[model samples]
Target: MGDEVKLFGMWASAFSRRVELALKLKGIQYEYIEEDLSNKSDLLLKNNPVHKKVPVLVHNGNSIAESLVILEYIDETWKVNPILPQDPYARAMARFWGRFIDEKVIGTLHRAIIFEGKEQEENIKEVHKELKLLENEVKGKDFFGGDTIGYVDIVAQVVAFWVELLQEIGGLELLTKDKFSFLYEWIGKLQNIEAVNECRPPREKHLEYIRALVENAKSGSK
Candidate 1:
């Protein structure tokens, strides 16, 4: 029997983007189900009972949650274009960088939007520092792993678009080419790829969505 593949995701989710890119890279055909995060679907909650989060990949009636875990599953299921490296040590490095980007870079950037004054200033510093570490990693390569996109590339993709959008909308300067030269250039390279570009959320709509988040936070506090 053919596998029934479906993806539960939100348009503006960077985590969702990771799963989409992995499927695209492997040339897998699957249904894309967009979820309204505020009012999540029963399907989403049922599939991902633990976190009630997105980027859940349903294949042959089996559901996989969490973006990183889903990426590994996708790569293992369909090996046409490998997302991970073959060597055990090399694979370990790729996994390390992926976790680093999520824990350090993404969290710090979110903090920049959430906190203010002293807290925001600290977050901004941490973001720059984390980005600097990533910049050094990509100093002499086309991407995190190599010339082509891989697991680490997908994980680091938030910087490919999210950082730029946040900077424009929030009037914050982060991930500038002047500072993170290779890392900044790397974003443009990743964006230029047809697969990555196709899955990217439309900029105008995404801006509005993110702005609403900030506005809602402001209103809630007041």
Candidate 2:
């Protein structure tokens, strides 16, 4: 018998969307369990004992946490339309960029949007620098790994979506046309993909959520 697959996720999380995109891209049929972060399910807590995070992929009672790891697991297990390149060197490069964005860019963007004062300014500049580096890294490519949408593209799509939402929340336009032309164009291309379009939440809904989050952060409440 095939392994029973279930994904624990939050609808609005980029990490959750990353796994969802990977599953859809690979044409994997699985149950999607929407988790309330405020009241995380017992199964989720058990599956991901360390992080207690969403986007946990459980297969045949074996659970994997972290979006990037889950994406790789999905790609390797399904092996139909491959998300990562077959060549070892190319796959390494793809993994490198994915990790870089996860470690450097996303964190910077989060800090810039969620915090205020000097720390936020520092984070904004740091995120801008990272985007500049990415612009150079993806100079000639349609996607991060060239013409086709692959692992890097999947990672990028979620990040770009959150960045756009954060832009609205912060009421500032950091990713302007002149500053990062390549990323601007790339985000448009990613947004137009059918899978992306289907899974993405409405922009207004995201904005409303962010507004509430900002209010809560200000008041220091749960």
**Worst window of 10 by summed lDDT in candidate 1:** 213-222
Candidate 1 lDDT, 1-222, residue by residue in tens: 677999999999999988998998888999999999889999999999999999899999899999999999999899899989999999998999889988778878988877778988898899999988888888888888888889999988888788888888778878787888898778878978899998899999999998888778757765
Q: Pick the candidate with the highest TM-score.
A: 1
CA lDDT, every model vs. true structure? 0.88, 0.84
Model 1 regions lying over 4 Å from their true place: 218-222
| Residues 1-222 of candidate 2: C-alpha lDDT, one tens digit per residue | 876999999887888888888888777788999999999989999999999988899998899999999999998888898989999999999999899989988878767777778988888898889889888867778888788678988887755777777787787666777899988888878877888776787889877887787667656732
Model 1, residue 205: displacement in angstroms? Answer: 0.6
TM-scores, one per candidate: 0.95, 0.92
**Highest-lDDT candidate:** 1
What TM-score does structure 1 among the candidates reach?
Answer: 0.95
